[model samples]
Target: MKLSRHSDYALRIMIQLATSGDALVSIRRIAETYGISHTHLMKIVQSLGRAGFIETVRGRHGGLRLARPAQDISLGALVRHTEGEDGLVDCAGCLIAPACGLPSILAEALEAFLKVLDSYRLSDIASRGRMLRALFDISVPTNP
Candidate 1:
């Protein structure tokens, strides 16, 4: 199944936050880094915040961070939140809607796909924190 741009951005946002450690990341920074629209990224950020995936801080020094640890955030759950309950095929108005076996087949395929994602957590993908930070041009904090 193809993922929406919204889901794609959401995953990117999660990865950014995961790689940042405890630092708060701004929407503008993320938008610029990904070369995506700032306005569009804000909407996605709001959706992720509402879904409890990330937390949004207000006022000066404000930005975004994960609501919980990366290890606790499941990839399948994030995709589900962003993808919604819509099925792969919209057979509602089709003449073969009632007779088609394609819907069931697609549903099974989707389930299998999601099951694979379920096996991974955000931490699993964001394990290369140092490399990700460097790639994003984010400064790595010094240990003192």
Candidate 2:
């Protein structure tokens, strides 16, 4: 199953913040470090904020931070917050809802997928992110 770019970026932002270890990070730094649009990342941050994954601080010395410990945030929860309740297939309100097996198949797969994701926390991914980035020499933000 392929992931959306938005979800990918959100995970990056999470890891970046988690690795920074108490440093308040700004959108521009994240955007520049990841080579993504600050505009797009800002929207993702806003959604994550709304979902209670991350919190935003205002004013001159303000930025963003995780709302909870990295290990407490589940990937399934993050994706649900980012993508909403619609499963992989949209058969619930589809025209083929009368006869298609798409809904059930998607529901089953989605449940399994979420179960797997739920097994890993933000901390798990953050550690993995550091290793993978280091292996590939990817310039992930390691400090504020």
Candidate 3:
């Protein structure tokens, strides 16, 4: 059950925002911090913004911040929004698929994986705010 890079970036973006609190963070800075391409991060940021997880501001002093509090942003929901609802594998037209339980097993495993993620919010993972801020070399907001 490998998550796509898109989903991975979405999670990273969420964590970055969570650690920053309400402070606006630039995509270019985040890309530089994570060593990802600005173009790729832009795509991910667009997706997240569309999904209402983050808000983007335009113009000279513009940047981005989480749309909602980190405590309200469920990891599972974010993954589902970014990763889509595609099944882990395609059993259609497979030999012996009717008799095979692999599909159900995989489905259950995926459910379990998501269940664990569902139990946490961005704040849960970003609770070590100071550490994360220092790691990213970003100043943590005093009021977060």
Candidate 4:
């Protein structure tokens, strides 16, 4: 099943945060990097913050960071939070809804899909920190 843009954006946001180390990232910066709507991202940020995935710091030097370590954030959990419990297809209006087995099959497929996601964490995807930072034009201090 195709994931919603909301889920996609949320994941991107998480990855961006994951690769940024301890530095706080601004929503505008993320939006500019992804070429997404700043207003739309604000909503997603609010949702993520409310769900305890990311922490938002307010002020001039303030920005955003993960609420916990990247390894502690499960992709499956993030997807679930962003996508909610909605089924892949809305078979409710179908005439054969009562007898159709598609819903169950889709449910199983979604479970399997999420199971794969569950096996991964934010750190897994953001492991290529140097590459990601370079790609995003983010600069992190190197150890001497």
Model 1 agreement with the true structure over 102-137: per-residue lDDT tens digits: 999999999998999999999998998778889888
Instruction: Write down the lDDT of every candidate, Cα atoms only.
Output: 0.93, 0.80, 0.90, 0.94
Encode model 3's per-residue lDDT on 81-112: one tens digit a residue: 98898779988899999899999999899999
Whole-model lDDT for model 1 versus the true structure?
0.93
How do these models rank on TM-score, best leading?
Answer: 1, 4, 3, 2
Q: For residues 38-58, what per-residue lDDT tens digits would candidate 4 score against the true structure?
A: 999999999999999999999
Model 2: lowest-lDDT 10 consecutive positions: 135-144
Question: Residue 123 deviation, candidate 3, in Å?
Answer: 0.1
Error of 4 at 17 (Å): 0.5
Model 3 lDDT at residue 134: 88
Order of quality (lDDT): 4, 1, 3, 2
lDDT of 2 by residue, 1-144 (tens): 677888899888888777655668888878888889989998999988988888889989998888899989998888777666777865547777898887788789988988899898888867765665564344667551
| Per-model RMSD to reference | 1.5, 3.9, 1.5, 1.4
> Model 4 off-target regions past 4 Å?
none
